[model samples]
Target: MPRYLISFEKDAMDHIREEDFPEVTKAASAVCQEAEDAGVFVFSDGLSYDDGDVEHAVVAVDGMVTDGPYPESKELIGGIFVVDVPTREAALEWAAKVAVACRCAQDVRKFRGPAGV
Candidate 1:
């Protein structure tokens, strides 16, 4: 089974009202549940950087550690769902559901397997 990544940009949720988080979470969870029921769920999680609270964020090079992402990205992934499905179309369908549930557009990409395998 091939896995696909389904995610949304962080800025996509910026305009969403804080009070609406509960409803959004509920809706998103339902989609996740549906995926689980279909046996395609690998894993899913949301980033807590919304309030600028990037838990344990750090950068390290040559044993030196710094508190930052070397080069800031204009678009950061807000949440991700990895699903093991048989086809791209199935993955896109899941992404579509995720987009509607999260009230944001979703990005989909297939995962590469072990090198040369």
Candidate 2:
């Protein structure tokens, strides 16, 4: 089975009021449960909302480690779901369910096999 990544942008949750988070979370959790029940779920997790808390590391050519959010991305990953499925269409279907559950758009990508095979 091929694994697909389903992810959401960080800014999408910025406008959600604290009080409403529980409901939104409930909906999203339900989707995760569904994925598990279907046996397609590999892993799922959410990122911390505080960007300041994130430590980005860069490994130099000589293996020196530097810390910072490199590449200066305008968007951050809010959450992610790794699902192993049979086809791209199946992945897209899962993404759609996730988007609705999360109340935000989702970005889907297929994982490259080992050694890019």
Candidate 3:
């Protein structure tokens, strides 16, 4: 089986409202459960809003640490799922399910295996 990353992309701050978030969260969790039942789910998690809350770190040549969100972008990786599937087509199907569940766009990509068999 191959591992694939199903990433959900969207403007993190747009859809999250304090009042509506709970319902949305419940729905998302239900979808996750469905994936788990399907035996293709390995792991899944959602990221926090792209506010300054994220602790960013950068490594310098001398191993010094610098901080901040790498660069700014219009969209942020809101969530991701690591799934084990037999083929790319399977991964895409899983991504579609996630997209519909999250009510957002999902990007699926097969993960590269470790160097040298």
Writing each residue's lDDT as its tens digit, candidate 3 over 32-100 gives 788789887799998765567546465668997767544554556778988899999988888887776
Sort all candidates by TM-score, best to worst.
2, 1, 3
TM-score of candidate 1 on Cα atoms, chains taken together? 0.86
Global CA lDDT computed for model 2:
0.87
Over 4 Å off in model 2, which ranges?
49-54
Question: What TM-score do all the candidates reach, one by one?
Answer: 0.86, 0.86, 0.78
**Lowest-sum lDDT 10-residue window in model 1:** 50-59
**Preferred candidate (TM-score higher): 2 or 3:** 2
* Clash counts for all predictions: 0, 0, 0
**Superposed Cα RMSD, model 2:** 1.9
Worst 10 residues of 2 by lDDT: 49-58
Error of 1 at 11 (Å): 1.7
Error at 93, model 1, angstroms: 0.1
Residue-wise C-alpha lDDT for candidate 2, range 12-111, written one tens digit per residue: 7777789988998899899989999999999988977555764557677898887654465677788998999999999999999988888888999999
Question: How well is each residue in 56-96 modelled by candidate 1, as lDDT tens digits?
Answer: 35555666766444555567788999999999999999999
